[model samples]
Target: MTDVTTPGTPVSAAQLEREADITRRVLESFDGCADPRLRQVLQSLVRHLHAFVREVRLTEREWDTGIEFLTRTGHITDERRQEFILLSDVLGASMQTVAVNNEAYGDATEATVFGPFFVENSPEIAQGGDLSFGAAGQPCWVEGTVTDTAGKPVPGARIEVWEADEDGFYDTQYGDERVAARAHLFTDAEGRYRFWGLTPTPYPIPHDGPVGGLLEATGRSPMRASHLHFMVSAPALRTLVTHIFVSGDELLDSDSVFGVRESLVKDFHEQPPGTPAPDGRDLGDRSWSRVRFDIVLAPGGS
Candidate 1:
């Protein structure tokens, strides 16, 4: 047999196809990867990506467009905003991912997506401190306990909370110097805690990216239902990332992110006038919403 070689020549059709085959074959290299979980995740990702390509009959131009769209999404992000998270929310990826990891096992608090706006290291305020920071909105009092699956109180749990104002705007949206509608509190010995904050209002997810374009093309609205965000953590329990939603939020049925779990919604009842708050603050002449709920957590794994 005679050997034929074409040095520095453009790859032929058979050669190009062979290269793709080699790439796929190389992905199978992970079959022997050290970490089982990582191997499974990568293998599944590759399979789905390849399947999606075939299903969509994707083209080179379309792939380039996708890359450009992602680049633009990254370019638009700033300190207080994240377009990638926005993209995930619109595509239902964020909700689906949370649902997979945060199953409500035996009445444990249901987890939800941690939206892009949460600021870490928020100022710690005493129980019943006003998270609303005197902002104008329907007032609300939230009280709850953190407990283990056995119903034993989990004291010293930290509850980090944030929510939108009456107009559905976060304090960060207004560029405010003071932290409004956000606070951190610790549970008492009995695992009980309470705080004051504005009742949440339905708000729109940022709609100025590729995701927004997809929504517009599909004739979908971008509003998220009214809800309160909470990041609760304790010394020996799985940290919870979840939300308490207003029961009657108009957009609940059509939440943009698909994050409204029926079990997570509760009524925000108006407190009667002149009722004294547990913290001894006079709830005089003001309308307020009240939520009394408890959280359950799984035991630490072995």
Candidate 2:
């Protein structure tokens, strides 16, 4: 047999092995996309995805299983639950996105994953009010200040807060009528805020779905460290989405969603029985814990 080949032509065997060519071709397909940003993102995604497939030499069966897993994840997602976000959280993608986009300025609060449980229009709460209605947990007092990078108070800052009960469940996880352990409040003129709630406790990410299956198959724990979630916003400062972790939590080093950072860990002081609360509420004999999570908002945006 006679071979017909050109000097600049790629040979069939070599062409098949040049995996990067596949990525290039996929990227080229989006060249006509009207949105430059979307085109750029898709191109990068294709490159990374192809690189990943090549790195692992992914087999047909593995690819099919991944597709099936994603399909199932979507099937299980709805208004109440978000399996895709849960998957991203478990894979560390959500936290990485936050880190890339929310670089702190001066002493502005660091950002973390927004988790899947935040609700719109949470009931407005007054300072010193309790958020632990119909929820079971150790009593806790949270006080904080919203400030600028220069330490000036940002009065009237809106703070949206949520967290699991001591038994590791959010208000959303219950079907009951009453809401618990979550509320939205505003800072006082001095930029100080306070509320009463349950002490945070470590809990598992929902482990009954596809993401959970992936965790079990990969030998990873689904446990998140004890923490309180906060989203703080002011007129001219960037909105901050973050969490304050329990300082001594066992899972701080192994949060299932990789959301823990050293700076976000805070001490939850155990108040002795019959002590006067910071808000001057008199409790007869009930022990309580207190955490002060002051926040500094980045300047600009919303």
Candidate 3:
């Protein structure tokens, strides 16, 4: 009988390959688990992640740095701030996702990212109430109607509106007392609604996290054009989350989130000073900026 001798602790190229194969096999074990959708998602993620590591020939130092960056991103988040959303904004992921899901349904209003600054449960204000909270900037009157695709008014739709101040900062960023710029309004029987607010001005997104680092590395500015954010919904129609951008904003072409759509841009015309108040409220000599937009909603099951 012949006896074969093996090293006391063998660590050959073949052994290394076997170890790597075992690790991959253990991870891939979940590929056939229950819930086909979960399996599909996880499998795809694993495949792509592994491919990325190989494609980039990623080093341990790079991986550690990435983990640290993500940790810091979480560290900077709070009730009024979200560094992760800012990261997605700088990467254009938010806009890309919105555009992908906002396909036209017979001229329905275009949808845009909701952004990270929206505060739930804003004060409800009657139509024509000044949303400006007395802040000074371009005087703008925003009026619009919620309508079905057939041009019929869809009354009783809820419209939640918010926008940056004249200087392009949100009320939350300023203080709770500045909540005047945010309001919720429901359309009347005529499907019409209006509000008074300052024309939005281009403002920079928060630039103090990983997102800021990315923007700086890419030579891209963090400014978003002046615009009003809207979230509108009706019982039988698709909810629309969008923005109305002031035409001719200097940063329109370079919006940090890539959210500027040509169709969403409208001119803010200056109404004559000393104009009579249609609602009989005392509006002083301030020049009012006016813009009118109509929303078309998709029919049920659309």
Candidate 4:
């Protein structure tokens, strides 16, 4: 028998066995890993990775290209930008992780991606206070209550909120020390909270880096639907990281990160100019928007 080969010839049985042996060897090498969980995860990862390589017959040049792509992804990441997370997001990995962590639990609010723009120690606002911080956008009144699955109020819950401005840029995108359009506030005794924030608006995920390139190459849009981000937590409730998207947003069906959930959409009622503000804050001749998002948290978590 001859080991003859052609440019597109099928892989020979002997060659397949050789590759399988390599995968087996790699798996066996982790037999002594002290952490059982780590070993299990790595072994499974190796199996899937090897299977993919074999199935695709990945070429050396292709592998080099992939390594270079990852290098570029890391180079562009910084304190303000997270290219890796963006990659996971566009590829649906982030959503998969979210789904696995957040299973159905009664009427608990569905969890979504914790986007890269969340800043720690955001300025705190009181109930009925303004979160806009003078950012540019139509004023919107946002009110909601924190409750458990049993419909009982969870008072004193810490709720963190943030969003992009009308122009689709978060405060961090400005490349300076400005914390506009984001804040944190605790719920009142009745587990009720309210604030004035910019009307949620559609925005593009940071698309000037490697993740953006991937989207362009794959013929996908980088624009996310308009949404307001929220992170709510209490003593004995699951910390919920989610978003409330605006109803009637065309991009809702095509959100770049696949973060839109049908249950998360809420109507942002339009308030015509001269409509009296709910909190007595003057809007002058400017039309505003308002929305209510009663959040139900699943019981049991730190």
Candidate 5:
């Protein structure tokens, strides 16, 4: 006896039958898809989309509005700004995809959202080198070791590090070809790596587009927690893209992209002014900080 009358507006049983028939026909049309995975995905997507339409009883005007919003999102996307990725991020789709792909195994570190700022063929640096590259921020000495989930060292792992400057902007945002606060380094034979980079400061995701409008309409913040980005890779090991958030950052609970994981937060111990550097490089009268992030990568097959 229960049907469309259960929620939304009361509708006749024949109306429900008509709507269901459309969904069924659409799903059946994909039965001839050449790819098995494509057919499965199409049918599943149709089922969920039809169910959503029915559940919400979406109005034509609302659908048109959504279409317009998506069109604007595409219009604002470019090589410098990936609005689609930003949209996926704000909707939690990126993190969900990351979660689905990066299965947990032992103490291996968790994965996180890969933001829109990554560039290919970053300049390589040696261990104990400065990654800051003259970017503006408090000096931070970052050191870590790369190991497999089995606790075995994975020497020569390539670790890519990048972060925003103190003014809450990446070097790319300066509208020039300069590369600062970003570099890659190889672990030593002992699987240890170190570099100098900025202590990450809180920043806003580029939110001036339709995605920003959506966030504003929903009463959500566009701020991300202070954190450092890392992309670690080695042969026979799964590549991991993640961030190490400052432990005491207030934005930890509310990163705009939902990229924060409890395991990824670490303490950045502050060193007083005139403190001796571990590598014997003079930090001068400037205060500095250090953090250790020992990474554990899962096997590639995982």
Candidate 6:
């Protein structure tokens, strides 16, 4: 008889014992993987995946459905949209990864999810310039300071800002506009930056696709709280990607992406009509809001 102990050879086992042996063999087969780190990660992933399958006693049909779902998610992803990222955000994986990667020391700004809406090569704008392109919403003045953890200013830090209008629709949502309500600016010598933006409002995640279907099936809401997104960067400091949520928004307690942190919540003071803006520009006769968000960055390579 052929040797049964050899790799790839048949072996006899009770049905209950087969799964355990298979797990062991699959892990052992990676012993010669050249990259040690890759081996370690793949081994761990295999263990967890196998454990999950066993715990759920996953059915064949369920497995096939999952494969098909992932296939569709990949198919829908393109330059302007990312369905896979939406799936990860809803599943909490994206936030968890951010938390693991960003452990700021002292009063450094906390990091949050880089949502699917971010676009590269945003138009550079001057301080206090309006970012909205006639989008519907009450204009708001946003001013902020950028500093190191030691409380020293970080001048010339690049600040990229973007947000949805009152209607909960981003400029990218409309095909006519290439860019709106999003721009980049640099901090002044005092580490201060300002811009005119819209008061963020609650909006639903794109729910016309597979990720949306998953949310609905799981009895989850897809509403994200009102918030302003920021990506601030400076020399010798870690780039910070985060958000400042509008205080008192109904969905703040239950942001669909779980991106909110207590430290990131901020109050937007409502100013009466004709209140002067931060850059000495007149607000005319319309009401506006003001918010101050100061950021502290951790040293680079931390």
Model 6 agreement with the true structure over 268-298: per-residue lDDT tens digits: 9999987776677776898989999999999
The segments of candidate 2 whose C-alpha lies over 4 angstroms from its true place after superposition are 1-21
lDDT at position 158, candidate 2: 93
Top candidate when judged by lDDT against the true structure: 4
Instruction: Estimate candidate 6's RMSD in Å.
Output: 5.5
* lDDT by residue (tens digit), candidate 4, 154-174: 999999999999899999999
Report lDDT (CA) for all predictions. 0.82, 0.89, 0.81, 0.93, 0.92, 0.88
lDDT of 3 by residue, 1-302 (tens): 22212334344566456545755885689966989888877877776776566446567999999899899999988888889988887788898888787778888888888899888898888888876666657667788899988888989898998888777678878646567678888898999998877777888998867778878988989888888899998987888989999887888888889888998998888677788656665668766678888887776533
Q: Which pairs clash (backbone N, Cα, C closer than 3 Å) in model 1?
A: none
TM-score of 1: 0.86
| Model 4: number of backbone collisions | 0
Clashing pairs in 6: none
Model 1, position 203: C-alpha lDDT score: 86
Judged by lDDT against the true structure, how good is candidate 4? Answer: 0.93
* Ten contiguous residues minimizing lDDT sum, candidate 4: 1-10
Q: Sort the predicted structures by lDDT, highest score first.
A: 4, 5, 2, 6, 1, 3
Q: So what's the TM-score on candidate 4?
A: 0.96
* Candidate 5 lDDT over residue span 57-144, tens digit each: 8899999999999999999988778889989999999999999999998999999999988877889999899988889999999998
Better of 4 and 6 by lDDT: 4
